[model samples]
Every structure is written in C-alpha cells, then in structure tokens.
Target: MKTRKAKEQIVKELKEKFEKASLVILTNFDGMTVAESNKLRRSLKEVGAEYKVVKNTLMRYAYPGTPVEQIKDAFTGPTGIVFAFDDIVAAAKALKEFFEEKDSKLKFKAAVVEGKVADVEMIKQLASLPGREELLGQLAFTLKYPVNAVAWSLDNLFQKLVTVLENVKAEKESA
Candidate 1:
C-alpha cells in the first residue's frame, strides 16, 4: 500500500503526463504477464511512449478539468494507458501491432488523441495511420512531383526546340 504522499505524487505526475501527451491510449491489460507487459513497455519506449497502469480513482483525480475528463469512464477495469509524446501515429501503430501479435490479449478501450475522444474503432483507425516520418516523406514526394514534372516538361520542350533548330540548320545548309 502506498502512503498518501506517494499517491498524491503519482496523481500529480499522471496529470502532468496527461497534459504533455499528444495521444493517450487506454487498454485493458488484465491478463498480461509480467514478460508481456515489459515487452509492451519496451516497444512503446522505442517510439517515445510510456505505458502506465493507473487506478481509476487516481486517473479521475488527475484528469479533472482536462480534456481527458471526457473519457473518464474508460478508466474502469485494469487500465493501462500509453502516453505518446513524440509520434502519436507511431505509438498507435506499435500498440496495434502488439495487439494483433498478442492475439487480442491486450484489449482496446478508448483513447484521447490530440484532445479528441476516440472510440475503439477510432483507435483502430488512428493505429492504421502512417507514422510521422512516413507521412512527411509522402508529403515531400507529393510536393516534389509537380516540380519534377515541370522540369521534365521544360527539358523535353528544350530538346524539341533544339531538334527543330538543327533540322532547319541542316535544311538551310543543304539548300
């Protein structure tokens, strides 16, 4: 049993984390073994995320007056939340892969992503989104495509004009 001071400190920390996190994914890790839990924690860490098992009461106390209060009911059961600070999509994808690989041992609950309350299906959609770098790369490619096409067209036009000029020069020389 934790002392009152310790619990207060924990609640304070949880509140701070909730405020800092861009994505907060709630899961029911009721049947997870220690090894599985550690593995999941490590996986989340690799993507700049951390997982915590919090008491519903503590979560409620910490999340009051915050955007997370919207999903206060989700804190029931054995709640394990992943706080994603760096890349929300990467963390969600990681959790989704873990969920699939574990055969649904880690049950999906609800999530607060970018201050939006996401249901189970919405969480799945969030997980399916491409990672930050992938999305940025795709955007870069998309932005570059028109520029590349224009450059290619200009080169083609220049070549055509050069060919026409050469044909005229040759014709003039022969004449």
Candidate 2:
C-alpha cells in the first residue's frame, strides 16, 4: 500500500505530465509480455515519447481539473499511457504500428488531444497522419511548386521568342 504522501507526489507529477503532453493515449496492456512491453517503450522513445503504467485511481486524481478529465472513465484496467511533449501524430503512429506488429492482446482505449477526448477510431486516424517534420516538408514543397512552374514556363516562353526572332533575321538575310 502506498503512503498518502507518496500518492500525493505521484498525482502531482502525473498532473505536470498531463499538462505538458500534446496527446495522452490510454491502453490496456493486459497480456503483453515484458519483452514486448520493452520493445514498445523503445519504439515510443525513438519518437520522443514515453509510456507509463499508472494506477487508475492515481490517474483519475491527476486528471480531475484538466482536459484529460473528459476521459476519466477510460483510466480503468491495467492502463498504460503513451505521451509526447512535441509530436502527437508521431507517438500515435509509433504506438499503432507497434501494436499492429506485436499483435498483442493490448488494446487502445481512448485518447485526449487538443482539449478533446478522441475515440478509438479517431486515435487510429491520428496515427495514420504523417509526422510533424514530414508534414512541414510536404507543405513547403506544395507551396513552392507553383512558383517553380511559373519560372519554368517563363523561361520556355523567352526561349521560344528568341528562336522566332532568329528565324526572322535569317529569313531577311536570305531574302
């Protein structure tokens, strides 16, 4: 049994973590082996995320005044939380892929992101999204494409004009 002071310290730490995290995923890792759990942790770490197993009671206490409180009921049953300080989609994708590959009995319960409680399917959809850097790169490329195309077209048009003028000069000289 935990002492009251220890429980209070845990709740305080959990609250701080909940506040910093962009996304909090609740999962049940009932049947996952130790190796499998370690593998999942490693995968999460690669993307600057961490996973923790917390008591449901402590979680409920920690989330009472935050957006996470919206999904308080989801804190039940062998709960593990995967969270990231920066990229939500990266963490989600990592966890989703890990679950898919391991085929473990663990299941995603719910998630809280951007002040909303996301459903299971929404969590999966979020996971499918590309990471922050990839999305930014795609956006930058998309934004630059039109300018590049216009430049190319203008160069082609200038070349064609030059060609036509040379032909005219040649014809006059020949005439």
Candidate 3:
C-alpha cells in the first residue's frame, strides 16, 4: 500500500525508463516465485536489461509520448516490463534462454523494439539472432578481412620484389 507521493514517484521512474529503453517487452508474470523472479531479474541485469513489475495504471500514465504507448492493451494482466536500454537482441536472447532453462510461466506478451511492435514469434526470432557483442565481433572481423587481405597481398608482392632483387644482386656479384 504505497502513498500517493510514492506512486507518483514510481510513475516518474517508469516514464524515464520507458523513454530511455530501446526495447520494452511486456511479460505476463503470472506464476513466478520470488526466487524465480529474482533469478530472472539477475539474468536480465547481466545482459544490460531491467525487469520492473510496475502497476498497469502507473504504466499507463507513464506510457504517453513513448513508443510503447501504442500497445497500451499489453499493460493488462500480471504485467512486467523488461527494458533493454542497450541491445534489444541480447535482452530477448537472455529471456528466451531463461524460458528454455526453466519451466517459466512468464509469458511474453509483446515487445516494442525501436518503435516497432514485435509479436511473440518475432521476439523468438530476435532471441535466436546474435547478441550485441557477437554482432560487433562479426562486424569487426568483416571490416578487418579486406584490410588484412590487402596487407598480405602487399607483403607477398614486396617479398617477391626482394627475392628478384637478391637474384639480380647475386648475378652481378658472379659476373
């Protein structure tokens, strides 16, 4: 039983979090135990995501002017919001893995990712996709590949030139 001031503060915090979040996933935490909830929160936190169980009324008030506002109906049920401020895929992947690892009754209602609404299937696809660090590593490798190839080609050409010069010098010495 929170006071009016405390509820207002909660709304303020929700608004700020919603504003900053890149992906806001609405979860139905119907039968989650306290231990399971704590585990979920910790796992989400590990991947730069936050799980908040705010009241639907508070969320509705905070939803205005945010991307998640369009899916207002999702606020219904035992709603919990998973805010992925950094990388959407990583957060989705983390949640999906948790679902697989446990007999999780926490159902994902939907996600507003980058202002686009993603359905349950879409979220699953997102979870299957590579995470932020993995994607970045791939991008770095892709960017470095051509540069490395060119450097290797140049080194090979220089080595050939050096060999030719050495052969010529040896011939001159013999002459």
Candidate 4:
C-alpha cells in the first residue's frame, strides 16, 4: 500500500505532466510482454515521449480540475499512457509503428492533444503524419520553390539574350 505522502507526490507529478504534455495517449497494454513493453518505451524515448502504467484511481485524482478530466473514464483496464511534451506527431507515429511492427496487444484507446479529446480515428491520423524533421524539410522545400523558379527564369532570360547576340554576330559574318 502506498503512503498518503507517496500518493500525493504521484498525483502531483501526474497533474504536472497532464498540464504540460502536448499529447497524451492512453493504451491498453494487456498482453504485451515485459520485453515488448521495454522496446516500446525505448522507441518512445527516441521521439522524446514517455510511457508509463498508471492506476485508474490515481489518474482520476491527477486529472480532476484539469482538461485531462475528459479522458479520466478511459483509464480502465491495464492502462499505459504515452505523454509527448515535444513532438506530438512523432510520438504518435513512433508508437503506432512500434505497435504495428511488434504485432503486440498494445491497443490505442484514446488521445488528448492541446486539451481536446481525440478519438481513435483522429489518433490514427495524427500517427500518419510524418515526423517533425520531415515535415520541416517539406515546409522548407515548399517555401524555397518560388525562389528557385525565379532564379531559373532569370538564367533562361540571360541565355536567351546571349543566344540572340551570337545569332546577330553570325549573321554579320555570313553577310
């Protein structure tokens, strides 16, 4: 049995986490082996997320008076939460990939992002998004395309002018 002070500390930590996390995913980790769970933790760590098992009661205590209260009921049955404070999409994508590759029984129950409770379909969509670096690179390329096009157009115009001058010189010589 946990002492009152210990429970309070845990609740305090959980409440702080709930307030700060950008994304919170609840999952049912019923049949996953310890090794598989560890692997999932490592994968989440790679993307700067954390995975931990929490008691339903404790979760309720932590979430009371917070935006996370909406997901308090989903804390039932072998609940493990992945909290992403850095990159929400990366955390979801990494967890989804790990679950897919391992074929483990870890099932996503619900997710909350930016204080809004997200359904399963929304969670899947979030998971489908490319990682942070990839998205940044894509945005950068998109922003750079117009600049590149203008540069190419200028180069083509200069080439045309040179070509016209060369043709004029050729005509004079031929004449």
TM-score of each: 0.88, 0.87, 0.90, 0.87
Off by over 4 Å in 1: 102-104
Candidate 2, residues 36-128, lDDT tens digits: the string is: 899899999999999999899888889978878888888778999987889889998888787777377778888888878888778789888
Counting clashing residue pairs in each candidate, in order, gives 0, 0, 0, 0
- lDDT for model 1: 0.89
Model 3 TM-score is 0.90
Name model 3 segments beyond 4 Å from true: 170-175
Question: lDDT by residue for model 1 over 26-145, one digit each (tens)?
Answer: 899988899999999999999989999988888888998777888888888899989998898888888888988935579888888889988767767887888889999999999999
Global CA lDDT computed for model 4: 0.89
RMSD of each: 1.9, 2.1, 1.8, 2.0
Q: Poorest 10 consecutive residues of model 4 by lDDT?
A: 95-104
Best model per TM-score: 3
**CA lDDT of 116 in candidate 1?**
91
What local lDDT does model 3 show for residue 13? 91
